[model samples]
Target: MDSLEQLNQRLREGVRCDGDYPPVPGEGNPNSPVVLIGHSPSGTDAQTGRPYSGPAGELLDELLAEAGVKREELYITNLVKCWTWREENGLRVNRTPSAKEIKEWVPAWLKPELELIRPKAIVCMGGPTAQHFLGKDFKITLQGGQWLELPEDSPYLKLTGHRLDPKPFVMGVVQPNYLTHLQEHAPETYPAARANLVADLLKIKRVLEGKLPKPKAPKQEELDIPF
Candidate 1:
């Protein structure tokens, strides 16, 4: 899209899975050097007409602040633009988006959005979101902290419309949503999970300060003709 407003407008004008709610577009500085992507929006996001709302959002703000990252300067979006929620126990809860939904929203909505933002860093907040760009086998526990270059041939480029040289640094992190999940279902692990998320964000902070460099892109090999 030519403008962030156009991008948001496209979503609002046509894109709809749950038409009952307004689409939540990526917000913050459209040209931000950093972008934080979540899997999907929560019910609160629908209500607020923004991404990252409710309890998870509160913790996300605290974590970003602790990590010296300002949400105001970073663009934030989701893998899916809409809130993928279903009624359960008389309350709404986020649900796993179907393959069709992922195909419809992610490649089309998130791709051009990233192109417009042209972020230097892309932080995929959850495992599924990470794997969508990274390989399906990516494991956050092992690779979450590492800053890897998005290869020129990366499907991410085609999927997310990232074409700049020395493509954006990609890092996976335990989502704040997961932290809330830990708090509710696995209380003992919440502290460590929270700590790790902060540590990852701190890396991003250092990257922005020119103190830490992301891994360089791989060089292409030359062909030799012995004839």
Candidate 2:
């Protein structure tokens, strides 16, 4: 089995991938009870060589503290390991990763990382991260904050060879960057957005401590909202 250090080395080396920016591996304790998965790194991540190190990261830190969780105690990573971007008007603008990129990278890189960490609960921050583990039709706006259980036979686990000893709890939330955007452009919605994210983080703490019931699969009717 590859160790976390080995995985980080692979990511830093940019082995087996092609992208303008070098891969940014997840950071924090490998055995952390909770794992945070984001969409992808931003240009700031490329410069700082850290996941969630930009404005989004700053807000995330504040939210983590509000939830009484230390940044060092949780494993943090991204769905796409690198900073995806495009040159526009002489500036590098971050872009959402294409589905093809996610499809290719998850199995080869993210899956193995999950297998190694084997977190008891996964907090997927943003649409891509949620959809990758949940389902393509997952809409964070409608289902955010609802806990969903990942069973032993879940394709995610089966693909990563994760053990069923501790069934993982998964929850979705809006991306921190999106929340920041709201704070800037849609000021009216910022408070509600931040509150929802804080609530989700607190729920994660409760789930980790067994203070709450394991999340059940959502009913089909519950998930019928337009994406």
Best by TM-score: 2
Candidate 2 error regions (>4 Å): 14-20, 151-165, 208-213, 219-227
Q: Candidate 1 overall Cα lDDT vs. reference? A: 0.76
The reply for model 1, stretches above 4 Å from the true place, is 151-155, 158-166, 210-212, 216-227
Tens digit of lDDT per residue, candidate 2, span 14-69? 65334556678899988787889987788888878899998889989999889877
Each candidate structure's TM-score, on Cα atoms with residue i matched to residue i, is 0.86, 0.86
User: lDDT (0-100) at residue 126 of candidate 2?
Assistant: 78
Clashing residue pairs, backbone N/CA/C < 3 A, model 1? none
Which stretch of 10 consecutive residues in model 1 shows the poorest summed lDDT? Answer: 218-227
Give the worst 10-residue stretch by lDDT in candidate 2: 218-227
The sequence of per-residue lDDT tens digits that candidate 1 reaches over residues 162-224 is: 566436788878777777777888999889878877988888777666564546333333431
| Deviation in Å, model 1, residue 186 alpha carbon | 3.0
**lDDT computed for candidate 2:** 0.76
Sequence-dependent TM-score of model 2: 0.86
